[model samples]
Target: MDANTISHILLPIDFSESSLNAFETGVAIAQKNNASVTIIHVQDNTFEYDHTNLHGNHKIEDNFGDVLNALADAAQLKLGKVPRLIMGEGPITASIVNTANKYSCDLIVMGAHGASGYRELFIGTNTYKVIKYASCPVLIIPTKKKFKQFNNVLFPLKPLPGVLKKYDLIRCMTSNNQETSLEILCLSSKINDDDEQLFEYLLDEFKERTEGVPTKVSSQYSFGNNIAEIILKTAEELRSDLLLLTPSIDISNKQFFIGPYTQRILHHSKTPVLVIKRNN
Candidate 1:
């Protein structure tokens, strides 16, 4: 279905600046589509502290509930539409994904905080987990309001079925062709003569897919030391608004993509990355 058909959206709020960025973006989309939003605060009730015979578990639980309610109430007031608040005990990322599915949410708007090195391994970013696991479409609002016009989108493609099948996700963002311009960008590490012809053929196919729309299609192949850095640099050169990719990263050992560059992109790119799952 089209964006206008979205009737209900799930927006998770943590009261952080990033979450607020997500909330504002969600509000605008909800208003445009006349969709109601459910603001969720996933409280991780697993905090460990020096419980040296000082406090009881019941008291801590009550305190947690109180904080959640206050946050929820404040969010309800801020939103143009009254929102539903849900409180649960578990991992924040898993909780939000389950709740979104339980409520049959059409979309999920969230904040993305890029992580680096050891921290990213031990404590995963909630936005990364949500995008990796969530069933609905997720709009990742950047830390800063660095939203450029989508006249040129840096779509880093790979030889994966999910990447090609995920045209639906890109379509959702660029559905409103009247206001936005969409482009399909394919980034290749190495280009053979045959690959060039194949890439050109795929560009033609993408053009047909976005037929009768105010959109441009392009492809590029870069041979370099760091592919993610190259992609980001190219996007900066073009002044792109968004970057699209599968949530798959490519660390040397734990590659999200086939190669060892996805992690680099996730950690370093300033561009807003739309990380979709295999099924999404």
Candidate 2:
């Protein structure tokens, strides 16, 4: 994104090491962009018999408030501004999204792992739900991956209908780093004369749009089943700092599923992922 593309950032914290790491990364971005920050904590306490109690909620609020205060103090030292922290009942996903919209947060930075820990994101938790429903883009910091200036970005584009539109989002994601080099992996299941022509045109189009940036566009043909594997491997091989993703588009048909491609990438990517869910 451009320096001003993000004016307000929303962070959802559960106090996991992963979430805390996300906190650090979010502040770093805010410092870079001169953006405002908001922290949200969702309380999921429900004892079916009695759900509403001020005392119980107060205890939980204190617990989250202590950590948030410490975090805000440190971040303020760097940002010269204090971040707003909002706490409410959960239904985690809905709370996070609603808080973001209510505060006019343009970007959400969150951790990839959930209760399952480092290896996987429970489909029902933080990153998945937030990306699925949030109005703005979500940046996911993977477990154990340190945040760095994005010098190289791995953008995997499948040659399905409407997939090329994702390139515009990639452009915005990398606009902040003029020195960033983008490696576009054009994946296709079946090769044809038309597809070959499309690849050539796509390469030219990508290069032209990235005027001051260094970019490389390559084609991986006849690779349908292993698209996710291919993308992860390339990002590793290139030592990419960020992996830009849109929802998966099935090449064989008109429908798409998040289970296969996007899930695999989120589950196993060593690089940070920026998920841009377009309204189309």
Candidate 3:
């Protein structure tokens, strides 16, 4: 019911329009929870690691601070406080992941460039690069997507056990309004008898937890070979504002989280996707 669930949020921006659009989402989340926000911009300067040129790097960061300060000033209008800024130097994705880990950020909100009309790293593949390596949850907001209330959510999960540990995270991301609701999409790759039972059980378990909460929760079971495609279709039909994924699969396991299944959803989903890190 409160942003206390999120203490600090890390935002990586490139000054691109898409990145600027994501600024609203990151700031909005901070404003909601009274949480602190840190805005980071990574510059892939080749000579950054040269200790001899440390002074030059410092000068560059000082210049970057000027722009970051302007951005912080603008964000203050919505955040009600000046956000801390970090001028990172290194590879785009690595810098982002390392900064989040170093600062102990609870969440990383970044922009996702659309299918066509691409600009740079935060687009198609590079964005996923950061998502796969981040220590915390990564929320991808599309360039054209509008920032609105988090009343409706679409959560998809497998029948695997121990995947519901972050159900509380889902609740915190949504509002407490009466009309606020969580839609659970029970996804199955086939019509196996055991998986079907587990699907129903997962749905009912979450549904029961909404009894006294301000949000209404409902679920639907879906069977298909192409689970990702089915999920995208369901999200469109429900007009979901956010797509939440909590997989039992670990990032390092033979069954990869960045495999084709999750990759398709993150790359193509029209709605924003919140990928909860396993260790988070």
Candidate 4:
């Protein structure tokens, strides 16, 4: 994210505290980047209606539009910029994606909870859906918290096939000015005993490629600690600005963010998380 360019920003508000946190973060980002925001509210009134009642359904739909308008007006005032509040008759996730594409938003900001089981299974998390479908970057703010300056960033990379290529892109993204110094931390828990030799080569290659970038590449072999736990602990100790990693969507197309480790982190950690999704 450059300091000067903001193109467009999409914010999904559900009136939840998490959503409001995301909205405030979006406002700060947009204000800094000089970008405008679009707020979207989807009305799910049909869930209360008796399917057989046709006349009652029409009234519900009409009232839904009115609710959207009111929410939009209130949001616009809070954002300090008039936002386009869009309403459509459908599921939340689909409507959000459709509205974002319609406006060509460059970034999507939303909140997520540590939901589990049937609730997540049936409703399909709006944040997860938006991340999978949005054409641009998505930033997930966990709760109502102010963003700390991102001085150090933990970027975990496995030698998975295309990992290097994505690492290259991340290096470029983190290479900002000297004031915002970023330390790139990479770790590997598997030990080959001959791992030092392999890492020597990998380290040299990364350094050579990231020359002009103001970043220090640190590498380590995970020592008896869980991968995600190590990451969370490290970030907490360093007070990192954000946790940057790539999520590999599994066969179910669900984001396997370090399996349940990510869920645990989100449930407990205060640090913001930035996930870069890449397709092979």
Candidate 5:
């Protein structure tokens, strides 16, 4: 999916501070890309209790609808004309995925915290699930991360077959501005003569595809046993504004199972992670 062609962005909010921060970030990105934003709040259906004898199901359902309307109205007022509001029901991750598909959103932006409770919707278990299952890319902003122009992006490259096509999507993120820069870190457990040749070949192809994009692109090789550690370290060292990753997953059983390295980067990276889900 080309992010540069983004016509709509999906922002899911829980009314928490982190979600608000995410909303602000999404607005900034929307403004930059000239993309319309759709803000959604998912009310968990599991929390709905059996009101057969109490207030009656209709009364309870009406109350829930009223609450959602109020929330949508408040969000629309706060966001101005840049966003359209949506109210969704069901499990948090499923609701978010469904809404994104319904809206044909090219990107999903949300805030994630490292703690549990209400904050868990974004950063806790839900965050991983969204990244794994979402049809589009998910941009995760940490609670403490403030919105800034993404000048430098750190991308970690794993030499898996058919993985090079993913670089085209990265161009979409930076295509809006010529000042954006990209640094690719190609990591391997060992570097031999053949490995160096292959790395150079891949790098050349990457540079070829990314040419004429106006952004500065550079690459380096790192010998490492721990891919996640190397990626995080390099990202921090470069002071990257965004971390781009195409997470490795196994879907043979029709279930999303994240790779260990991808999970670690999602949970530990301080910078915003732009998770580009690989097509099946």
Candidate 6:
């Protein structure tokens, strides 16, 4: 998807500190790109309610609506501008994905952790599901991280066919800001002649595509067997504000799936990681 064409950004809020941070980051990006923000709060519908007591059921439903409205109002107030608020009820991950697709969101910005810590919404369950299933790009912000200038963006590159398509979204991301520099961190376990040749080819293609773009584009190679570790180290060394990753595909099963390395980066990266879904 074209970054310039990002008209809507989806932000799922659980009212946690991390969710709030993600909301702010979403708003920041929205304002910068003149995009609208859609705030959604997914209410889990798994809780059982007694159908025997009609009055009690009505009261519960009313309370749920009231709570949703209050949360929406709070989000709007904090956002400083009116945003489209959606109240979703069902499984959390499914609700988020459905809402995003329903709204035709171009991007999803969410927190990496919720009130229940890493094992909750962002890190363990919902976040992973969204990244794996969502058709659009997902930007995950850590709880402690704040909205900052994207001066440096670290993009981890793999020598796979049609990998250049992943960078198209990056162009959109950095289009408005001329100061944003994209650092391409190429990783390889062995620094052989073939690896160097592949790196050069990828770099050339990148340069060709991003020729007229104002953002400074550069490439670096890291010799490491562990792709995740190399990516994290490079990001930290550069003080990268954003990390871009195209998840590895596992074709071992009947259907392709997100690889474990992507999960590792998502769980460990201190900086916000923009996970671009591969064209499978």
TM-score of each: 0.71, 0.79, 0.83, 0.64, 0.79, 0.81
Write candidate 5's Cα lDDT for 25-86 as tens digits. 77666665667778777767666433232234443345545644554565455446536777
Q: After superposition, how far is residue 35 of candidate 4 from its true place, in Å?
A: 3.5
TM-score of model number 3: 0.83
Please report the candidate that would top TM-score against the real structure: 3
Q: Residue by residue across 106-131, what tens digits does model 1's lDDT show?
A: 78887665211224222137776776
Give candidate 1's TM-score.
Answer: 0.71
Q: Ranking by lDDT, best first?
A: 6, 3, 5, 2, 1, 4
Cα error, candidate 6, residue 183 (Å): 1.1
Better of 1 and 5 by lDDT: 5
Q: Given candidate 2, what's the lDDT at residue 78?
A: 85
Using TM-score as the yardstick, the better of models 1 and 5 is: 5
Candidate 3: tens digits of C-alpha lDDT, residues 1-280: 2223887889887655566667778787777767788998877664332221223334434455676788788878876877888885678888888888888888888888622246433345557888878878888888766564577788887777667666766665666554676887777666789988887788778767776888777888877778778888988999998888766422245322576667778778878888875656
Model 2 scores a TM of 0.79
Task: For candidate 4, report its TM-score.
Answer: 0.64
75-155 per-residue lDDT for model 6 (tens digits): 566556678878767888888888888888999999887544455323856777888788788989887678744668888
Supply the TM-score for candidate 5: 0.79
Clashing pairs in 5: none
The Cα error of candidate 6 at residue 78, in Å, is 11
Model 2 spans with C-alpha error above 4 angstroms? 1-4, 46-62, 115-124, 160-178, 213-222, 248-259
